[model samples]
Target chain A: GIQVEQSPPDLILQEGANSTLRCNFSDSVNNLQWFHQNPWGQLINLFYIPSGTKQNGRLSATTVATERYSLLYISSSQTTDSGVYFCAVPGGAGANSKLTFGKGITLSVRP
Target chain B: DVKVTQSSRYLVKRTGEKVFLECVQDMDHENMFWYRQDPGLGLRLIYFSYDVKMKEKGDIPEGYSVSREKKERFSLILESASTNQTSMYLCASRVMGGGFPEAFFGQGTRLTVV
Candidate 1:
């Protein structure tokens, strides 16, 4: 089983601020994904980056598979971005599609 | 976009009662999973089904069981619900392929057992 650890368990940011959230894994992963659980408890899919870098609007993510680490960057954060940011890696295999998730980073964007 | 619809947004059940949480995915994905999220335990997989009529136990499957009779639906059943089983349950579906297959989640169901 792979282990996922997220840094800065709690975070607070003002509007228009930028922040970087980090995730470190213990083993090689075939899949890596970032998720945002909004205040309404809807788990929104942020990014599915197994390797390399990708940017979506003001949010970007980079996964260095070789180093077993990933970083999620939020630029000019808004109040709507306040939620629990989670990074998940591979868990089960063969026919099972599972993800092993970290404890998650709680982001608070103040007005 | 993939849509995973859960049966209930919130449910309250009494102890020793049988509970069923239904999940349906519109994309016809082969892999469907049920996970329980707690305060400190993060998200723990309870069960998953890769194909019709096939199921596999996940990390926390002691008080949970799953059924996948149809390709698009996966149901988690608690034969005899207990107080400790109260938690947030999430359903997800994913495609099976060679590359990076992303898993899509539902809007979670918060269950309270008394």
Candidate 2:
């Protein structure tokens, strides 16, 4: 099984600040995804980047598959971004590969 | 848009009581999964189904069971609920593909066992 590790288990940022969250995987992965669990406990899909870079509004993500690492960037952070950010990847190969998630980074954006 | 709907937002149950959490997807995805999220443990997979009438056990499936009678619906069953089983349960659905596809999650069902 592949292990996913997220850095800075807890983070706090001021409104309009920028921050980066990282995720490192122990083994090669065919699929990688970023998720945001809001204060209400709803898990929202952020990005599905197995490799390369993607940008969505003020949020961007880059996955260096060769390095077995991924980085999520948030710019001009807002109070609404206060929640848990998670990284997930399929545990193994084949169609039955289930996603294994990291503990998550708890982000607090002060207004 | 992909929509995953959980039957309940919150539930309270007693020990030894049988409980069922229902999930339905509108996108007709082939893969459906059940996961439990704790305070610091993140999301742990409990069970998953790749197709109707097919199922697979996940990392933490000892106290849980699942059913996939129809392509659009998946159910998680707890035979005898216990306090330790109380947590937020999430249901997700993803399309069947060779590469990693995006999974859409439901709002989650918070269950408390007493």
Candidate 3:
């Protein structure tokens, strides 16, 4: 089993601020994903980056698989960005690779 | 859009009652999973199915069981609910592939056992 840890357990930011969240895993992973759990408790897919970088609007993520770490960046944040951000990876190899999730970083973007 | 639907948004049940949480996916994904989320413990997998009639236990599957009678449906059954079982349950679906595709999740069912 792989262990995933997310940093900055809690964060508070004003609208228009920028912040970065990080996730570190204990072992090599074939899958890495970033998710946003909004206030309404819907887990929204942000990026499926096992390696390299990807951007979607104001959100972007980079995963350095070689380093076993990933970063999620939020720029010009808005109140709507307030919620918990999670990073996940499969537990191990083979057909039973169920995803294991980090505790998540709670972000509060105040207006 | 891809969607994983859970049957309930909130539920209240007695401690010894049997409880069933239903999940369905529209994308015809090969993998479906059930997870419970607590305040600080994050999302812990309870059970998962890679195909119809196939299932596997996850990290914390002690008091839970699952059934996958059809490809699109997966059900989590609590033999006898307990106060400790009260938490947010999430259902997710994903395609079976080497790359490990992103999983689509349901809005989550918040259950309380009294």
Candidate 4:
């Protein structure tokens, strides 16, 4: 079983600020995904970066597969960003690729 | 648009009741999964099916059973629902392809066993 660890379990930020959330995995991964669970409990896909870097609006993510670590960056965060950010990786490097998720980072953006 | 739809958004049942959670994906994905999320446990996989009539146990599969009779539908069944089973359940479906498969999730169903 591969372990996924997320840093800064709890986070609070003022609006218009910036933040970075990190995820580290115990073993190699075939895929890595970043998800945002909103207050309504809908998991929104943020990024599908197994490696390299990608940006979507104010949100960007980078996964260094060689280092077994990934970073999610939010720039000029707004109150809508208040929720839980979760990072999930494949449970194994094989073909099945069962996703194992971290405990998640709780983010609070004050308006 | 690609969507995964769960049968219910909220449910309440008594202990020992048989509960069924249904998930359907419009994308015709080959991989479907069921996961339960607790306060501190994140999202633990209960079961996943990669194809029709096939199933595999996940990290926390005790007391949970799944059925994938059709390619578009996957069901999670609880033989006898217990209080400990009360939590948010999420259903996801992913297209089986090369290296870039991304999972799409349903609006979670929050169930409580009384």
DockQ of all predictions against the true structure, Cα-based: 0.65, 0.82, 0.77, 0.67
How far does residue B6 in candidate 4 sit from its true spot (Å)? 0.4
lDDT of 1 by residue, A41-91 (tens): 779999999899999999999999999999999999999999999999877
**Best-performing candidate as measured by lDDT:** 2
**What would the per-residue lDDT of candidate 3 be over residues B42-66, giving only the tens digit for each residue?**
9999999999999988889999999
> Per-residue lDDT for A1-111 in model 2, tens only?
788999999999999999999999999988799999988788999999989999999999999998999999999999999999999998878776788899999999999
Accuracy of chain B in candidate 2 (TM-score):
0.99
Task: Tell me the spans in candidate 2 whose CA falls farther than 4 Å from its real position.
Answer: none
| Ten-residue region with minimum lDDT total, candidate 2 chain B | B95-104
**Candidate 1 CA-lDDT value:** 0.92
Judge candidate 3 at residue A41 and give its lDDT.
83
State residue B86's C-alpha deviation in candidate 1, in Å. Answer: 0.9
C-alpha RMSD values across all candidates: 1.1, 0.8, 0.9, 1.0
- Pairs that collide in candidate 3 are none
- Restricted to chain B, the TM-score per model reads 0.97, 0.99, 0.98, 0.98
lDDT of 2 by residue, B15-44 (tens): 999999999999989999999999988999
Model 4 regions lying over 4 Å from their true place: B98-100
> Could you tell me the TM-score of chain A in candidate 1?
0.96
Highest DockQ among the candidates is held by which one? 2
Task: Evaluate all candidate structures by whole-model CA lDDT and list the values in order.
Answer: 0.92, 0.94, 0.94, 0.93
**Residue A2 CA displacement from its true place in model 3, Å:** 0.5
The sequence of per-residue lDDT tens digits that candidate 4 reaches over residues A14-81 is: 99999999999998886899999999898999999989999999999999999999999999999999
TM-score of each: 0.97, 0.98, 0.98, 0.97
lDDT by residue for model 4 over B1-114, one digit each (tens)? 789999999999999999999999999899999999999889989999989999999988999899999999999999999999999999999987656489999999999999
